[model samples]
Target: MQATPVNPHSSPLVRVALLAYTFLIVYASWYPFSDWHTIGLSPLAYFSEALPRYWTFFDVSINVLGYIPFGILLMLACYPWLPRRWAALLCMLAGSLVSGTMEAVQTYLPSRVPSILDFITNCSGLFIGILMGCVLTPWLLQKDLLRQIRVRWFVPSMSNGLIIVALWPLAQIYPQGYMFGLGQLVPVLSNWLNIYLGIPIDLGSFIRQGAQLSIEQYWLSETIITCCGLIGAVLLFLCLLQPKAPKARLVTLLIFICLGVKSLALALLFKPEHAYSWFSPGAQAGLLVGCLMLYGLAFTPARVQRHLAIFMLTISLLVINFVPGNPYFTDTLSTWVQGKFLNFNGAAQFLAILWPWLAIWFLLHYQPAKSTNPA
Candidate 1:
């Protein structure tokens, strides 16, 4: 007897979603909630907070509840491609690996505290999701709901944009100086351009001196950062979309969203007050341009989009890091390293903040060009 063929669409969607969710968990685990400093505790202190309450209904319910979808989705994605037993085993491994990684990274986030509960909860979610998928697959296939959902919600073209939009708010959980989202790079880049080009722009001062949009004492600085930042993120996603590589597009969007969520959480953990300050036009415009660029790239050939994505992200990362006055050595080395070398404070700070992300991105094999081209 011959084995049945897997649906062309199922596997890719599952892989993309799984990879993206993994990133999200890692991002969320790192950032802790506000009051971390006032409590005189590290971000991982929350692990203890969740401990005494571990056995309570809330803890178990939340843990198991949250991951049910993950497990189900993982199972659904895998079942079509692998043997049932093998798929189950794979799901379990994937769940554990993702949860473990998130817990490990949590140690570095100033606001994020690692916890056994989170690991357990994440695993539970994966397991439950897998189990649900197993139970529902047969019925879903019978009713054709599986195929319907896959075609409708999981289709690469339609799903990619929606998933990114959904993940947008989640990414804002991290509180950075920039408001909108991970697009903090925009304002930082803007400031860098001003300084490098000898253009006079006083963003810092503009932010501090309360600018009003009518009667409200608005922080125009935050508004510019957040709005423009979000636009930039969206554009970044759009730029990576490849018409022939739906799977790649889906995967990219998922990863981006997860990163966005984690970034937001970290922002909140470190600077809760600035959590709501991410709605700026500069950031928004950047995001819009980014989205346009992504759309253009999506229509381009796969090979070109891949390199372009990598180049864009790399440049953005570099700008975000190099342009800022190093928070760590700015005062001490202001005179010596001003234009020639390192801003001790800025470099130290950038490293402190982004090193974890770099590590995760590296470990995850984050190839901007890796695609879902079945061919």
Candidate 2:
């Protein structure tokens, strides 16, 4: 079917979104990114194996579904700049290239098993995703739905909300000392530097260990961190929402989404029986306080919201990074075995740890459009 031709102007947002997702896909596939020795066996040798035995539907489903975004995003990214046919062909070809790269790299990893069946499924998914994009783009682009959504729900010239919204759920995949504690990178970076640079170092731990905490102090720290983290993320998102938008409702929805992601992660990581184990007294207190804060500030101007968000984020990161890791949190980490899942785990942790900082940076540079859209 022919596409509905509109203006040929390319959206930088689409390009950025595509690149961000591409990085995630590559990270998910090559996670851990270590162990380089290889046998004489060709990486392509997997293609010659006998047909794959009965594989679980979950793995097959996830593999096929995961690549769909790659196709969709790639096609959309190219739609404005290239002919329709060329754009789609390039999109699928890029996806195939990515799949091939992942499979080839898996040959060196002792944990992963390279399978041609997986590659085939991925290609199929990419193709389907391209078709979906072709059908959907005409409506999404031609109808001006995204623009309407931006004006109604987001700050006119900013996309900080979109990026944060996407990362909010993915960040929950990693365990944090406090609820909504997204940026906790100092310790991890410290450890990495210590290992590679051969120095005993960790800025956060060093600062945190300066004072020992009692039971009450630990509880207080957790409460403060959680409250600040929650308030900061919500305000940051609110800063992106238009003044006329439903700030309270959207903030409520954001809170629910974050909690939902956390709950899902807990269920997956542990068991359904212990899914609620993360809801502690301190977290409950923080959630209550944070919601109150959101309600109070939901009426503030977007600029004021941005300033408050910056302040809130600065405090949250300082406390979270400076404070020692919760000893209680160690119990949860015990169940996590870094094997084949190491790569995915590592990537998720990186996102969870660095996310808040990324948001802060984005907010710092964010600017609202100077002119109003003509009616």
In model 1, which runs have C-alpha deviations exceeding 4 angstroms?
1-11, 31-66, 104-115, 139-146, 149-156, 169-211, 216-375
Q: Tell me the whole-model lDDT of each prediction, alpha carbons only.
A: 0.49, 0.76
Candidate 1, residues 222-268: lDDT per residue as tens digits? 33333334334443444344334364456466546645554454442
**Over the stretch 1-375, how does candidate 2's per-residue lDDT look in tens digits?**
554454476556677778888888888877667776687789989888876886767567768888898888887777766666777888888889889889888888776778888899889889999998887676666676666767666656565457766687789878787777778878778888888898888677577667777877777777887888887788777767665677667777777877887887777676675567668877888788878887788777777877888788888888887777777787776875444244478778989887888878877887644324343
Residue 242 lDDT in candidate 2: 61
Regions more than 4 Å wrong, model 2: 2-10, 51-55, 79-90, 108-113, 197-205, 337-340, 368-375
Q: By TM-score, how accurate is candidate 2? A: 0.86
Global lDDT for candidate 1?
A: 0.49
Q: What lDDT does candidate 1 reach at residue 251?
A: 46
Error of 1 at 243 (Å): 18
Task: Choose the strongest candidate by TM-score.
Answer: 2
